[model samples]
Target: MRHIPNALCILRMLLVVPIAWLLTAGEYKATLWVFAFAGFTDGLDGFLAKRCGWMSELGKILDPLADKILLVSVFITLAVIGVVPVWLAATAVLRDVTITIGAITYNALYGYPHGNPTVISKINTLCQIVYLLLAVAAKAGEWAPDTALLILGAMVFVTTVVSGIDYVVTYTRKAIAASRAKHGLA
Candidate 1:
């Protein structure tokens, strides 16, 4: 029972490669189905972890790591196959890279962060996932409209930028406070 959440996360991570491969092979419908299953596992894992008290430190790290790999791989593969716009994919990747670097530096200088997701960060991730699903579905069929995709893309961009800035600002403040405390000034 305690291991269920982490196991789900590991399963999600394992799904990343097939998702990317499907995207690359232009099997948009298959990609969408696989991606949806992976996303479902993501939500289930988090729900079980928090609701059932199955949370562990490794689960903390593995869950988000799996999400990042899945999302990043899908975005990159879609961009390569010309289903998703390069700019949007680049923006998503850049934001993740920036956050990763920030976290690494913070951990080295100030010890590990609590690894909690902020509200805006969570919103940004949701937007990204929604936009990706829409894009993939559009590619899989003609159901989604261009106007909707445009609007969703714009929302994703805005949220990505805002959340990235929020993370930097929040962590910078934390780092500064930690430094001040170490110097006996806080």
Candidate 2:
């Protein structure tokens, strides 16, 4: 029971390769099913971690890593196949990359701050997932509307930029405070 959350996270990571392969092969239906299963594991892992007290340091890192891998892979593949916009995929991927770098820099300078997702960040993630699902479902002949995609795409872009900037500002402030404390200047 203690390891269940981490196990689910690991499983999600493991599913990335096959998901990517399916997307590259233009198997949108199979990709959608696999992605849905991966999404299920994501939620389940988080629930078990919080409700069952099964959280761990490793789980903290692994869960987000798995999500980033899955999302970025899918977005890039979709963009490459011309199913989704390249700019949208690039924006999503860049936001993750920027946040990751900020986290690492903060850790190196000020020790590990618990990397909790902010409300805006969570909303951003949800938008990205919803957009991806729409894109995939549309590709699979599920009748996703063009206007809907356009609206979601705009939401995703706005949220991604906003969240990325929020993270940068938050981390920069924390890092500055830590530096000042270290120098007896706070």
Candidate 3:
């Protein structure tokens, strides 16, 4: 039971290699289905972890790490394949960079982790999936899907930037509180 989350995380990581292979081979259709499966399993992992009381400290770290690495690598690969626009990929990846830095800084200063996913962050993730689907579909040379990809990319870009700011502010406050406590002033 306690291993469910780790299993899912490992599954997500394993899926990434094939995703990269599919993209490199220009198999967007296959990539679409596999990517969707990975997304579905990602959600299932967290739900089962909570429902089955399978959440461990390692799971706390591993689940999100798997998601980040898999999704980030996919976005980068798609950009390299010229299926997704470089700017859109940059926006999505930049938020990841900001969140990672903030997490590390918060841990250093506060001696604890400070966040789960914010609503905005979840919205960003959903938008990213939409963007990926659209981008992959666009590789089939359909204009309508390309339009949707453009819209989804814009939403992802906005949500990602918004969530990045939210995370930095949220975690910085916690770090500041910890600093004050260390000085006996909190």
Candidate 4:
């Protein structure tokens, strides 16, 4: 019961391989279904964690890691298959990489860079998810228009840049403050 959220996160992570394989095989319809299922598990797990008090330290780590794996895998696959712009995929991957390096450095230098998702970060994630969903749907069923995808991609790009900057700026400030406090300069 309490571990349901963490289990769902693990399941989502495991789904990444199939999603990538489906995309590569040009089974867009199957890929869409599987991706949607993975997304649903993401939401379900978050809900269960918050509503059922099933949250744990492991859940905190696994949830975002699962999302990154799923999104990055799908984005790279879509780019390779010519379903999406390579720049979009590159931007997504780079943002994640930058954040990962920053988090690791901050954690090692100060302590765990503790925080919650900023509003912009949340919006960025939503844009990315919606864009990916539409991209898969367009490939699967021709339900999403290119114009819509273009607009969503732009939104994703903007939000991703903004959120990446926000994370760096916010955490850098925190790290500076922590350093000052440690040195009794505050």
Against the unseen true structure, what C-alpha lDDT does each candidate score? 0.89, 0.90, 0.82, 0.90
Q: Which pairs of residues have clashing backbones in candidate 3? A: none
TM-score of each: 0.96, 0.96, 0.92, 0.96
Q: Per-residue CA lDDT of candidate 3, range 1-186, in tens?
A: 679789989999999999899989988788888988888888899899999898888888888788788879999999898877788788778888888887887777666583688898888887887678667767755444555666777888889889888988887777787789989997
Put down candidate 4 lDDT per residue, 71-106, tens digits, no spaces: 888889899999989998999999888888888898
CA-RMSD of model 1: 1.1
In candidate 1, what are the lDDT values of residues 1-186, reduced to their tens digit?
Answer: 899999999999999988988888889899889998998898999999999999999998898788888888888888888888999899999988888899889999989888698888888888888889989999999489999999999999999999889988999999999899989999
User: Candidate 4: which stretches are off by over 4 Å?
Assistant: none
Cα displacement (angstroms), candidate 3, residue 110, comes to 2.5
RMSD of 2: 1.0
| Pairs with steric clashes in candidate 2 | none
TM-score of candidate 4 on Cα atoms, chains taken together? 0.96
